[model samples]
Target: MSAAPSLPVRALAALGRPVIAAARATLELWGVLIGTLAGIIRSYGKGGRRPRGAVVAQMYAIGNRSLVFVAVTLGFIGMVMMYQACLQFSRAIGDLSQVGLQFLRLVVSDFGPTLTAMMLATRVGAGIAAEIGSMKVTEQLDALRMSGVLPIDYLLVPRFLASIVMTVALTILGAAIMYGAGGLTAWLSFGVNPRTFFDPAMVQPRHLALGLVKAVTYGAAIPIVSGFCGLRARGSSEGVGWATTAAVVGSSFAVIALDFALSVGALWLFGGDL
Candidate 1:
């Protein structure tokens, strides 16, 4: 028989188990994300088949369904931003119009994309995970394969594209509503005219483009992360539920992490003065 481990060895082994498991999980997740991206690229290739209906449907679900939710949440976020910043900007600049200038810069540069992605992670990411996890647990994925339907193409590709397109569009819409809300809040609460609270010139093209880039990056990532968790789910309904939770948590973390990275990159690449 092998010699029993010493206390130090036992402790190290115990620590190693969790660390190894987390490393494996992370590697598997990266593989899944890369494979999903490859599948999308293949579908766009001449040798591959593209699925249009699935893409459209997912766009409707991720984009159209999210409109009201994004609108309401972002609208309030803008008002809150105005309430906090109006006093500071007005007092400093002695011009409430400066509030609008500052608001646009802050919202477009950071808050707009980050908040939208986080909200979507909880809602759309969770739903995608649960739905696909249930299918995985039920052997539906195998059935699709048996029927000659590639799950990556029919399921993941559509979601990937839809999320990017819809997220970008929805982010624009939400930002519009948020600006309106900020203006209204500034006018009524701070006695700043709504018109003066808006100056399109204060926002640079880079700011707007970077915001969309962030949104698109997050949009594409959520599906890959959620679908990875879902496709790997096993065991009972409890397992599926856990997978759903994992998807949301993982996607949310990714959204925040990516936002930070992208924000820094944007600043470095474009040199955002604001």
Candidate 2:
């Protein structure tokens, strides 16, 4: 009886921390969004020089540096998706066409793009938070502000744009690879023609549109979460680490929740067509 009570207490304490942390994170994210928007308006009102160079640099950093990791991760995802899908298809159906359709539905509709975004959020989003948090701790951001540089436009906007580009590109690439791998596996196991794998008709335009919407949504959400978490850091190394973790976790939850919402919205909009 005592053990049970103690376990509940500990669990509640653990749960409470995340709840408070989430609330704080939410406040910080709103602050960053408001501040960034205000800064944008101010820049436009005063005809302030846009930080075009910095934006370009940030785009390159976020999009380019992330490519190798995204490719490798996607490759493995493709391989595994092929193997598992083949096993499942083998159990129920003897037709390779059926397997191909199943693969298309799974990859195009949800798994490929959603999983890719989650992985990117975990990998690059955390890094962005830590980097910003470290810079804040060192007063580098303050120094930039003192020098008349708007950090949001210079740093955050580029990341925001880059995330969308990266998410879309990576997901498409992953889906292609997964389809190819699954096709190959199906050919070997069930003697399906490999060419039957990537029928243009199977490439649903609606799924692609859904993926684009999701990528852009995630792109916007990640930078906001990361930038906010960094801004809220308590100016210490430990704080930086904590902020990084918060950014990843918060952004991940945001991605998943948004995916579900988008799925529902997409269905409502296009379910009749499908």
Candidate 3:
């Protein structure tokens, strides 16, 4: 046999493994995304049939079920943020006139969609992964494959469609609650007038567009990432558990990454106006 490798060689090999694994995972994710897109296109083609009421069911599962959790979380966050801003203004600037204006602009353009997506990444992502991963581990996915069905079409497409709609709706609801709660806190805690605290004059059309775009992008990402993790599950129940955890982490990371990229692009496109 050949001599064993040196310590440096072993260390280099270990370092290279993770790099290669990351590259492979990235390519696999892109493949899943492409396959999902293809499945969507195919669904619109001749002889393509989607399950009845599937999209609506998913919408209820993803959106309606999440309403109270999202609303309460955002409401409390808004109150705390407004209180902090008022306190800082009282101590330093002594003028709180622009606080609500700036806060509303930030919420519409960033916080509302980003925070809402983060919450969904944990709840929705885990659910998708758990369900699909269980199916995978039980060989149900293989059965579907044998039946001439594309797994992405049957499994992920409805979710993709529903997520896009629900994410946008939730973002809108969350933003409204956040703003309303913040205004209430500002009035009660700082004696600011509701008329001044509820102003939306500073939010431009571009802000609305950016937020919508981000919400849609995040919605698309979560299902794709979660499904990919699910399909990759191995072994038994433990594999499903691992996939669930990975789905949550991956979905959350995708939201943050997409948020950063979209924000930068928006800033570049709109320049000083943004």
Candidate 4:
């Protein structure tokens, strides 16, 4: 009979554990959000050390290491789009001569940049979150603060700058490869000449503009998502794993969501062909 009272106590404890956990998660998320914002502000305000060298180092790490991954992924993306489009177009329309045009219209305006961005997000966003989260867990962030170094200026700003640059550059490369490489394959497969593939009149300035926009949006998304997750990391190896997964998933969703918004805006502002 006494066990009945003990059961209720245990039940309450179990329920209370979950509620406390939920509160803690909410607090952690908010803390990270706030901390990231503060970091951004601090990055902008940093002026010491006669212009810090840390930004350069960070740029090298974030931008340079990421370039090869972006390029290789985008190259394969180009091949896939070309191969798929060729298959579909040949079956339906027999307009193989228009392959370059088709590639430009679809890949340049949308898929190439978006896919490339998502790939970069997967590679870089998770990495950043894990690296930073691990750093935070190990107290490296605190060590930086103790040394009187503004961590954001030294850490986050470089990542922000590098990611934006990398995204834009990689997107441009991806679009080119998709259009150029895809066009070449189309030409070779269907007996079309090189002139059809290289003609400048086939490309649209508006689509190019849209590609750049996608790249910039993607660039902005990766670091912010990564930084957010990194800041939010707490407890155990499981927490680091969770943060990495969240960073990748969150950044991917943000990239896709932003791409859609950009596509719509581009289409509306620049016309349907965009």
Best by lDDT: 3
TM-score, each model? 0.94, 0.83, 0.97, 0.79
Query: Runs in model 2 with CA error above 4 Å?
Result: 1-24, 37-46, 272-274
**lDDT of each residue in 1-274, candidate 4, tens digit only:** 3545578888999899999987986686556545645665765666533223655665666667766776777677776777777788778997666776666767766877798788888888888899888877888889999998765555666677677877777777766776676666666666557677555565677877787778877887788778778767888678889889999998899898998898788778877555
Mark the regions of model 4 whose C-alpha exceeds 4 Å error after superposition. 1-52, 148-150
Better-scoring candidate (lDDT), 3 or 4? 3
Cα lDDT tens digits, model 3, 1-274, are 9999999999999999999999999999999999988998898778878654888999999999999989999999999999999999989989999989999999999999999999999999999999999999999999999999989899999998999899999999999999999999999999999998888899999999999999999999999999999998999999999999999999999999999999999989998889
- Report per-prediction Cα RMSD to one decimal: 1.8, 5.2, 1.0, 4.6
Candidate 4: count the clashes. 0
Error of 4 at 24 (Å): 11
* C-alpha RMSD between model 3 and the true structure: 1.0
Candidate 2 Cα RMSD after full superposition onto the native fold (Å): 5.2
At residue 5, candidate 2 shows an lDDT of: 58
* TM-score ranking from best candidate downward: 3, 1, 2, 4
Q: Candidate 1, after superposition: displacement of residue 88 in Å?
A: 4.5
For candidate 2, lDDT tens digit of each residue in 17-114?
Answer: 99998798678678788777666566556777665666567667666776777667766776677777767666767445666776776677776777
Please, what are the lDDT tens digits per residue for candidate 1 over residues 1-274? 9999999999999999999999999898888777778888888898887878889999999999999999999999989888888877767876676778878877786788888888889889998999999998899999999999777777888899999998888888888888889889998998987667787777888888888888899999999899988987899799899999999999999999998898788778877473
Alpha carbon lDDT of each predicted model? 0.86, 0.76, 0.94, 0.74
Residue 172, model 3, lDDT: 100
